[model samples]
Target chain A: MPYTAEISRTNPGCFIFLVDQSASMSDPIGSGEMVQQRAQVVSDAINRLLTELSVKCAKEEGVRDYFHVAVIGYGHTQVGSAFTGGLAGRDLVPLSEIANNPARLESRTKKVPDGAGGLVETTVQFPVWMDPVTNGGTPMTRALGYADSLVARWVDEHPGGFPPIVLNLTDGESTDGDPTSAAIGLASHATADGAVLLFNLHVSGASGTPVTFPDGEGDLPDTYSRLLFHMSSVLPSHMRSYAASQGHRVSDATRGFVYNADITSIIEFLDIGTRATELR
Target chain B: MGAHSTHLDVQWFLVPKTGSSSEECEDAIDVLLSPETSSLFAAVSDGASESLLAGAWARQLVHGAVALMSAADEESVVGQDGLSRFVVEDLLARTVDQWDGYLAKYEAERIARGRPITWYEQPGLDKGAFATLMAVHMREAPADPENPKAVRRWIWRAFALGDSCLFHLRDGRLLTSFPITDGHGFGITPQLLGSRNRNASLIADRVSTATGELRTEDELLLATDALAAWLLSHPEVDSGGAGRQLGRLADLDQELFAEWVQNERDKSRMRNDDVALVRMRVKTEG
Candidate 1:
């Protein structure tokens, strides 16, 4: 019952995404058949997540403001808002604004099943809010600190609402310092519903089977992943249940950490928790 | 068909979800009165909240159900007990066809006004619209054709898909509850009628039907899932107290009903969702 608070326009939830834009992010990931830059993968993930959230909260009039979101990019010894276009320097913009003021819409071709035994090509409109930018070094600690301020303010304002969720996408190399304490400080913020959730997505150059929502860090590839795993918050019960339903092996101790794989599915987990149980 | 003196009192109320304006109510109700044929039709539909243009779809479905029930021939298969399934399924199929045309026109109008469908709306539109449906048809049996003054009885038939329910009460005691019998039976995913579904057999397999006789002073209640779930979950319902309470509620206006629903939600007794109810009373002499 802790995370069961009803999310409405009056008591909206919050999401703060921390993206790592260090020079190391330019390195290519994955093997021969499928190769992509870490920065590009992270940018694509963010755009897709935004699209999923918009679709989930869409109504006849437009998107509803059930959540406020902020995207922070860390690099070159500074951390600041990553949103471009009309929302360039803004933080914690309402979901409706985010849906309506995308930087631009790109037409992308996709292959979908045609209800027959074959597939057909179709064009889809993809909205972009941020572009890939790699700078000097990863100031992950500062990024977490920035999200800490947002989460703290959100909890103070909406004390009775579901706690804010902070997702950090990084390459596990913190140029400033170990971000453990910052991550802990960010996750410590709480509303009446529960403590803030801090999840981590580690985009590493090391090649290994992608591990997602692992219960323990013993199987992690290196010390960097283990450190980030320990910094990540345990998956809330509701999120764990959703992950289980999606065919992922989950347990009470499972932490929200994904390494070298698509993290866009996390958007679905977020929507499931904030879903309006009753039609309004 | 001959004109007959039969009286039926009907009332309906609806409330949107918490934090939503009344204009956003997704549940729809319709009452069809055919005085010449001595028949009365009522229907209620709850649109899927996750689907696009659900409220419009729900409105269309309820109106379509009543129109089909009213226009069917008395000697047709629709009038038979086991064969009504075909009629109801056909009605849904036709509604699906109409929905296709409606969607085309809606999209065209939006584009003509320079506000075409957004990227966020495209995925949901591909899935089409969805809703739950429940309908009732009541007709007065011909008074002894030879003795026009003889008292007449009414035969009522109901068809339901998903969680919407029909309740019958006699002498202020609950006599019957259709489709869903208990609160535990309700679930997040009820059988929904999709706008693209054209398989009549599939629809028929999911539809439930019930028939009964209505005498003077009998009361029938048709409610969407939220209120229906509350009625089944209330402790007093099994003892007939809930039926009496509902009968009293039938006389109140929409504003009062909305207040009552809000009070229930405040007390955490009812789930916060769109609620709708239609109450019908039988009168032998009026």
Candidate 2:
């Protein structure tokens, strides 16, 4: 019931994305045709997630501000808003503003089923809000702390609403220090609905079968993933149900953690909050 | 011998679900009165809120259903053994075909206007427009020459593909409720009619049908899921009290109905959703 709170424009939920922009993120992940810089992959995931959220809440009038969002980038001994263009340096912006003020829209070609067995290539408008940035060391602890402050304030302000969700996208390396305590502290903040949800997307170069929404850390490839898993909030029952519905092997104990795979699926785990009570 | 006949009193109301403005109401209802045949047809469709252009799809479906019923031949109208599987299936398949054409035109228009479909909208569109459909038809049986002064009887048939319900009341008591009977029956995933589903047999397999008799003063209520669910949840419905409440609304205008729905939603007695209802009463001449 915690995650079941109605998410309306009047009682919006919050999203805090912590993106690791450290130098090591510049390294290529996954060899061969799938190879891409860790930073690029994370940036694409963030952008796609934002687009998905915007589209989910979109109506004829435009996107509803059912959520407020923040994108924080940490690297080179600095942590700040990664939003570019018109929204540069802004934090916790309403979803309507985010939808209307995309840095730019890119026309991307996609192949879709043509209803006659084959695929048809078509152009689609894709909006971008942030670009890949790689700098110095991975100060992940500070990044979690930054999200912590935001979560603390958001819960205080929206005490009766669904708790904020913090998604940390990072490579396994942490140059600053272990982020366990910081992650725990970040997840400890609460609203009347529930405690903050700290989910992790480990964008690693290490090659292993990608594990997503695992209940235990036994299958994790490295200690870094295990640490992040330990710091993650268990998937609320509703999120677990959604993950199961999406064909992911989920259990009651499954945490909101995705390792070495596309984290775009995480967007589906968040309840759009408000039920369709009115249909206009 | 004096002639006896029955006429229909029809009224309909629609309100968008809570949290949505009135302009966003996606549920659609349509009634087709055929004075020449002394028959009345009504339909309601609830568009899946998750799908793109759902409101347009729902509106098209209900209109298509009514049109199909209006044009049915004698055999199709009476149906095979009281259930018109073929007619129902053909209606659904044709609606899907019509939706295909609509989607193409919609896409072309968007492209022509320099606002092509966004990546976000494409996936939902490909899944096709989703909606639940229910339709009812009522026709007066020919009067018997021997008993010309007897009360006229009307034959009524209902077809349902999802959670939408049709409730029949006689003498102010609940007579029958079709498709869904309890509030627990409503789920997040109701059976939906997909715009791209071309298999008539598949559509026919999911369709449910019921037939009954309506005499003078009998009332029939057709409702989309939200209002139907609320009606089913009340214990009074079994005792006919709920039917009386619905029958009383036959003369109320849309604004009053909207207020009643809002009040129910405020009390948390009904789920906030686009609410639709069509009330039909059988009238008799003394």
Native A-B interface contacts kept, per candidate: 0.53, 0.22
Tell me the TM-score of chain B in each candidate: 0.91, 0.92
lDDT of 1: 0.82
Candidate 2: segments with Cα more than 4 A from true spot: A105-126, A173-178, A209-211, A217-226, A259-280, B1-5, B73-78, B81-127, B171-173, B249-251, B284-286
What TM-scores do the predictions have? 0.91, 0.86
- For model 2, residues B153-268, the per-residue Cα lDDT tens digits are 78888888899999888866778888897889998789998888877767777788888998788899899998999888888877778778877766788888888889998898
Q: What local lDDT score does residue A208 receive in model 2, on the 0 to 100 scale?
A: 56
List model 2 lDDT by residue over A139-192, tens digit each: 989999989888888999999888898888787567888889898898889988
Query: Residue B26, candidate 1: how far off, in angstroms?
Result: 1.0
Candidate 1 similarity to native, TM-score:
0.91
